[model samples]
Target: MRIQEPYTSERVVLRHQGRDRTFVVVTPLELPEQPPALLYFHGSLQNGNVARNFTGRIFDDMVARTGAVLVYPDGVDRHFNDTRLRLLEKTRELDIDDVGFTRAIVDWLADNRGVDTSRIHACGYSNGGQMVMRLLHDAPGLLAGAATFAATMPAADNRVEGLGTVSVPTPFLAMHGTADRIVKYDGGVAGLDAAHSRGVLVSALESARYFATANGLGDPDHETVHGPEGVTVDSWSREGLPTVELWSIDGMGHVVPTPKQLPASIGPGTDSVVASDVLARFFGWA
Candidate 1:
C-alpha cells in the first residue's frame, strides 16, 4: 500500500518544568497494533513544522510503510538545549530540560497512542543531532536506537555536563558530508561564521568509534563502496548488523541527503540516498 496524505496529525501540548512544551505527532490513517515511535528533532532556528517540510516529508512515507508513529518536537526558542556548551546561550541560561521533555513525550505516547515504548527510536539533524547525542549520554536506556545527520559529537573539552558519563551501548548511525562547512566532516570548530559558530567537534569517524567502543565492539571491519550520485559509503560494522555505522557522502553538504533541493546556503545534497529511507531501513521499519 502506498502512503496517502491527510494522515492523522495532531499538535500536543504538555506542561513540563513550569513551561508549555509542544510536539506534532503524525500517525498512519489506519494505526498498527502498538506501533514503534520515531521522535525527530529539528535543527537550530527551525521548529518541528519546518523540520517536517525540510526533509521533504520523507518520514511520512516511513510511517505509511512501517506503521510507525512519527513525532516532531519543537525546541525552546527554535533551539534545543543540546550539549554544545558555547553555541546556544538562551537555552543554556534557562537550563531547558529537553531530556525531560523528551521523556515526557515518550511516556505520553505509550499512554495515549498505544505505542510500544521499548521500540521507540530517535533521529535529528545539525543541532537536533546534538540533542539526540544528549539522549544517548544522559538517558541511554530511553531509546532502542538513534541516528544523526549532519552532526558529530562535541569534543570532550567542549561538551556540556553529563556527557561522556554513560557507556550503555545502543545502536547508533551517523551521516556526514565531506563537503560540509557548517559541521566540518573531518571535525574541528563548526559554524557558518564567528557569529553562528557552535563549537569544536570530533571527526565523524571518531564519533562513530566513540559509540562503537562504548558498545564493546573492539574494532570495526571497514568497507568502502560506491553509491549513487557520486556518493560514497564508508561503513564500520561488527557482525551483519552494524552496532555503529557512519555514512560519509562526498560533495554533500550540511543538509540531509535527499533529491529534494535545499537552500544553497546549507550547500549541496545528493540524489543517491534519501535520508528517511535510509533511516527507516536502519530502524527496521521498512
Candidate 2:
C-alpha cells in the first residue's frame, strides 16, 4: 500500500462528563482490518492537532507505513490531569478523568473506526507521557503495548496508596533526553513554567525497572548501545515478559525526536533516531 505523506486529519467529538471532548484522527487514505490503533495523549498546554504537529511526520509516516490509526485526544484545557499532586498553573486547578476520555477513544475506534482491539497501543510525550503511565496502571488491558517520552512513574509520594500491579504483559518503551529542563531527564519535579507543578519524581531508570518487574521479568540484562555522538540507548530485558527499553539522549530536550538532523539549539534534535519510529518498532508496527 502506498501511504500518503502528511496524514489525513479529522476531528472527532464525544460527549463526556457533560462536556464535548474532541480529538484528531490521522490515518492513511485506506483503513485496514484490525489495523493497529495508537491513541496518543498530548502534552500539557497542547491540543490534539497541536500535539500532532509537534510529532511531525513521525506519526504521519507511521500511519502510512503500518496502516495504523493514530488518535490524538485533546486534553481538558490543553493539559492532562496526570499523576501529580502539584500540576501546572493551567492544569493544577482542573478535575478531569483523562483515563475515561482516553478509553472512549479506544472504544470509539474499535466500534466506530474499525480499529483492531487486539492490536491497540498507547503512547504519550511530556505531560501526556505521564498520562500513559496512569493508563498502564489504570488500564493496561486496553493496550497491546505502551510507550512514553519525557515522563516517568510518579514518585511514590505522588501516587495515593492502594496502587495496583498489572497482570497483563504489555510491552513498554520510555525515551528521554538527559537535558530536558521542562520535565527533567533525571526525573525530578515537573510542571514548572507551564503548570507551576511541584513534586519529587522517580528517575527514568526506576520507572523502567518498575515496569519490568511488574511484567514478570526477573533480573534484567542491561546494554548501552554505541550510537551517534550525544545519544545513548539503555535497554533492559529478561528471560520472558514484554520488552522494556529506555533511550537516554545527551543534550536533548522537550522535543519529540524526529528522524532529521536538528541544530544544537533545539536540544540536539536528530533524524538519526525518531521516538515515533522506535515506538512503532516496539509495537512491531514499523
Candidate 3:
C-alpha cells in the first residue's frame, strides 16, 4: 500500500526561559503502536516567516516517506552570533539559547504527545546541522541519533555550556554536495548565497570526518558512486562511541530533493533519497 503524508500543522510554541519559540510539528495521520520521533532544526537563514514557510515544505515531503513525527525549530534572526557575524565576538550575545530551546521542545513533545523519549532522533540542514553537533556534545543522552546535511562547524568557540570532549557522541549522518559552490566541502566561501547554490563538496566530507573521529567514531568509510538522476553520490560511515556516517552528493545542490513537493526556489534535479529515511536508518528504526 502506498503510504500517505500525515496530518501536520505549525505554530506549536514551546517555552524556554520564558521565551516562546515556534516549531513545525507533523505526524502520520495514523502512527504505529510505538514509533520514533524526529526533531528537525532548519538551516541558517532568516527567522520567523521565512523559516516557518521553508521548513514546512521540507517536513511535509520528508514525513511522506518515513512517516515519522517531525518538528522544525526556529533560530534567532542572525544566528548564534550577533549582527556583525563575528563568531568569537558573537558568542557573548547568544540571543537564541538553542540548547535550552531544543530540550524544551523535546520535553513538551514527550509529555503532550506520549512520544517515546528513548526513540527520539534529531536532524538538521546546514546551520541547523551545526546546531545538531552542539546538541550532541551538550545533551548527549537526549537523542537516539542525529543527522546533519551539508553542515559544517559554526565556530570552535560555540561550545555548549559544561560539555567536554569526553561526552558520549551521538550517532549521526552527515551529508554534503561535492559540486557545491558555497560552503565548499573544501572550506571555500562561507555564505548563505553560495552554500545554498550548490551541494556538498570535498572539504565538507573531511570536516564531517573530523567530527565523527572526535566523537570516538572510527575513521569514516567513504562511498562515491553514481546515483539516480545521473548524479554522483558520495557517502561515509563510522563506528565507535557514537556511530556516524556522511554523504557528499556529487554534482547536486543544497536543496533536498522532494520531487514535485518542493518550492521552486529549491530547484529540481535533486534526488528523492529522503532525509527522513537516512535518519530512520541511523536511529535503527524498523
Name the candidate that leads on lDDT: 1
Query: How well is each residue in 195-217 modelled by candidate 1, as lDDT tens digits?
Result: 87788999988888887777766
lDDT of 3 by residue, 115-217 (tens): 7777778777666666676777667678777777666653444333444452665666776665544455566445547423322223665666666666765
- Sort order, TM-score high to low: 1, 2, 3
Which is better, 1 or 2, measured by lDDT?
A: 1
lDDT score, candidate 3, position 173: 75
lDDT of 2 at 160: 32
Across residues 181-208, which tens digit of lDDT does each residue of candidate 2 receive?
7677777876545446657778878888
Q: How close is candidate 1 to the true structure, as a TM-score?
A: 0.94
What TM-score do all the candidates reach, one by one?
Answer: 0.94, 0.89, 0.75
lDDT per model vs. reference: 0.86, 0.76, 0.59
Which pairs clash (backbone N, Cα, C closer than 3 Å) in model 2? 88-195, 89-195, 259-271, 260-271
Model 1 misplacement above 4 A: 1-6, 239-242
**Residue clash pairs of candidate 1:** none
Candidate with more favorable, higher TM-score: 1 or 2: 1
For model 2, the superposed segments whose C-alpha errors exceed 4 Å read 1-7, 88-94, 160-163, 193-195, 259-268
